[model samples]
Target chain A: MSDTMTNTQATGGDGAEAPRGVENLPMVKALNAGLRQAMLDDPRVLMMGEDIGRLGGVFRVTEGLQPEFGTDRVLDTPLAESGIIGTAIGLAMHGFRPVCEIQFDGFIYPGFDQITSQLAKLTNRHEGQLSMPLVIRVPYGGHIGAVEHHQESPEAYFAHTPGLRAVSPSTPNDAYWMIQEAIASNDPVMFFEPKSRYWPKGEVDFSSSAVPLHASRVVRTGTDVTLVGHGAMVTVLLQAAELAAAEGTSVEVVDLRSLSPVDYGPVVESVRKTGRAVVAQEASGFASIGSEIAATITERAFYSLEAPVLRVSGFDTPFPPAKLEGLFLPDADRILEAVDRSLAY
Target chain B: MQFLSTDGVFSVSEQSEQYAPYLERLTEADHRRFYRDMSVVRAFDVESANLQRQGQLALWVPSFGQEAAQVGSAHAARPQDHLFPSYREHAVGFVRGIDLLNVLRLLRGVTHGGWDPKDPTNGNFHLYTLVIGSQTLHATGYALGQKLDGRTNTGNHETDEATMVYFGDGATSQGDVSEALVFASSYQTPQVFFLQNNHWAISVPVTTQSRTPLHRRGDGFGVPNVQVDGNDVLASFAVTAKHLDDARSGQGPQLIEALTYRIGAHTTSDDPTKYRTQEELDSWVAKDPIARFEAYLRSQNAPQSFFDDVDAEAKDFASDIRCRTLALETPDMSLMFDHVYSEPHPLLEEQKAWLAQYENSMNGGESA
Candidate 1:
């Protein structure tokens, strides 16, 4: 190891070459670091999925992993999402913590049947006698300027399943810490990594106090309104909050790390102070995570509400082309529009 | 013993003696009971298909000719043993004690999972899995858990547990199936991989799906493999019983391929006539599993009352299915948010509130 990168420090310590420690890495680099750390920490940790070995994944998230870890630990699997997950179940049973990658978000449909029906229910079906210690990493959401099926947001489908826990990370620190947390969890976790934000750089504190994957984080605090988002949309919500502040409005931003077993403490607390909220996502507005959040805020924080909780999300239409994606995605403008509407009410 | 056979009569291998005691334990009453279960399940299957045709059900995967394979294999499993079934295992679901109406609810699109796999009433059998070969790995993993818990073959037949997973010939080509076999063999998990090679997987024929046979694939992974006359209930029962015993006894995994035919469309959305010929359908009809089982029962001096009782029970069961299916109501859309998380989620709660207001506003001030 280089002298500059020797310590697992959150910040650089009087070193010229070291810039901001691990936190300054991108989401993809943070993930690579996290996987390496987990593998080094535990002998049982293994990675398996299509193109995860030689090809280093289509996103190059697993780039150079096979050469570093060897083929036995980092495996290149056959082209089958269902097989990837199904086999991961077996590997988990054999005392291996298999972190599987389902090449893309849209490609996971073939494996969805196994995930919801088998992987999710196995532990509960056996009354906790069997715990599927597995992680299914899916590159989800629109914004890569991809085609029709490739950019779909299907987190609600996995989150809806009973025995599965779904979690997604936004920043580099959360990405690094949560990936380790998810691997340590005995429950099956659908780790949805935002495909669009993989290249965005952030500060990751590897040795910093690690947060629970199931807990929500209060990214930025404000009082006028609570803006809730997760995965790639967290960055958008932050930008919206910044713009809102410039316009003489206060916005509290909540990055929901966990989709299933969602930590409502932060959200409820933020909303209690703010008295208004606007949930945002890249998934369709109809029957989405945003829809779920909007309902919960009304029920829990009904008396504190100055207006109905609004949602700024993708339209109830298919994810459009690369050119129209800017219009299709939930941006700062759309989020601000929802904030304006809620404040108007 | 007709097509896909070298002799006029199907032969049982000498190794099959291990299952002879269990096979002999099945009395005339047991045979009649299995027949009745198959009949009722088949009735429900047909009714659901008709319901789909009438636009009541969104889709129905018919379990017509594969009834004997499901019934026999399912019967071989003890109550303590768990099952992981593919979507078309109606007869297996019936044997596992699932309410026939619940199966219909899934086809009718009223519920994602019509019954709870963990419910005691479910008899340790999981809900149907629509994805092709995924359940095999789950079953294997669960069996590994059973072994870890020291619950396998405790010398108490009633308490000892094994896992049986159902899939099809088409699924044999899936990497999940092969990988599942590899893990099961390596861990020596108490799992029985039951493959019902029902001739066709959608439009692909069995010939196109595999060469050198499906059962042989299991042997490559070190799992003991066998092929049975799927239409023959006795063969299916004897074979499944033996393999299930081997698994429960800690002898590792086994693969059982039941040779049968689909006899109907893959699902209500499919049209078999467009791809297959009338002659192919007629050939499988001659080897109808239910008919052969009924004939075998008659030859065993089964009373006429047995047939009459089974038919009457099947009719009542079919009537109940029809009534319950038509009377089924769509679940509250908000209920979708209920089970997403075991703990209370603010996100879901907020969404539910917005939906309530949205629905109320849509209905002009009435809650849904």
Candidate 2:
């Protein structure tokens, strides 16, 4: 589950190093590998979260880390979110790169001020005299159907903040590389891990990454339409792309790995060729990542558009009961319908 | 418990006698230095309030009657320790190695932070946290870091580190404060929570903030706690010195509730006359920290010339601060985008460049 880049092809954009050794792992295992490698590389890298050490987290993403890295480096912190984040900021100021885990997306609100006000503003407040090299790993999004407050997509809250970096990984390989890259970064990063994809095994090319942590990638190519999304919504977008292609729609799917400071290069290029686009997300459409992408695409590719940029997203409401999550979350059918609306023009 | 009387006589009661040895560590030079600093900060506070009244500053947090608590506790901590201050620790900053003018830069609206704590000139005093009680958690975390790094409990006060966080009584009600105390006790971190119960949180009384004595609040968290007469600078120094020594020796976190008073308005903008009667204010004024220490100096047969010299030095210190503050220039517009992140952020960089170009275009048009 844990493998490092062994230097196959130093510079390529996609996972084409099949001749190189690869591992089949879930996003959880991939993230574990990435965190382990980062800790091994730097003595300052530490992991602190509730139940992260002894219980290996509620998701078990931090299993075997405490025994290997020792309890001092991998801490099972007290059950307090604000304390975890607040102390982590102090730890960062004391010259440690702390990667904190939020048990769930909803639990993060308890630590919201430390994250948004203190952690986000410390570096800027110190006027560059200090650097907050911290990572808050949030397991988010729907399709798990465990309970209320368990499944959510709150990346927009962090993405809207100016001093914080927000990113999500849609695949195992991206999870492995992006977590490492995020750890290596000197700024505070909100690492939104899609909980629904935690169990799905995918190809993790430990040899190299397809793109930089902040860059978006066109996972599939097409000529008629471009579908853009991030995290769990990305899998739904790919499913919709496959369905649209069956109907001869030829949809291109773009994985928006980075939420804040979004890399619109690949998405804009694909939309230029396709002449239409639909942005989807599990988060509510109003004032969300999906809305931002649609607005930006319309501004940058106004002349090339075949239609107004369409959005397929969660309804603007609190995540309903687990039974209603199916209707609430954007699926292949909802995205295909938005694709139909975009293609109509 | 009070160790220094309001008449400036130094004595130890049964409860405070244990802290008496800590005072022996202080030389006569330290005693004279404490009196001098308390007077200097009082002068600085009055001049800063005047500056705000003259519209030179946007607002001012007066440290009028709380100087003894701040200065004494500040001196107790070693150089290796980190101090996280609330917005009105002017006396603490003065007793520490920070230039008193940097605090004015914040009130003057020229900078969010006046100086870098890492800069030797500024000492190890971190930035002022206005949100209240927020810095307690930060200080606790810093203590945890020291503990994890094996920098605490080394039986060497010179090498071992501790954290001291200052907050007012009103901040104790904040959830972050409780969380910080919990974390500190749970981790057994080397830290001190210095709560300046100045009797008033703006208009609300300390009675509104707590039902029990504030020091015992730490008892609920299982942290060792004590209460002292905050106006007695000698008592403050002795108690703080003992606890700080205990914490560095890996005795876990300690809490000190310093009972003091706020003689002036909360800030320059507030009207204390609106809230309280003159009798209440006058009684606290009688226990003024500077006057009390002056009495002690006189009891020790200190010369009138020495008192006159201190008054002269205080006037010079305030006048110097006034001159320097008037000389501070408005910050550059470009600095607004700087330091948002340590690395180059594409979005901020582009926005900064666009703003510069837009401003330049406007300037060119004006010239034409």
Tens digit per residue, CA lDDT, model 2, B134-204: 89999998998999999989899887999999999999999999999999999899999999999889999
RMSD of each: 9.2, 3.6
TM-score of chain B of each: 0.94, 0.98
- Give a tens-digit lDDT track for model 2, residues A22-106: 9899999999977877887678999999999988989989998998889899998888999999999888878889999999999
Per-model TM-score (chain A alone):
0.93, 0.94
Score residue B5 of candidate 2 by CA lDDT.
Answer: 88
Which has the greatest DockQ?
A: 2
Q: Kindly list the per-residue Cα lDDT of model 1 for residues A5-116, writing each as its tens digit.
A: 2224323225432423445889998898777767766767889888888989888888877887787678776666775677677567556788999888888988876788
CA shift of A99, model 1, Å: 7.4
Q: Given candidate 2, what's the lDDT at residue A87?
A: 90
Q: For model 1 chain B, where is the 10-residue window of minimal lDDT?
A: B1-10
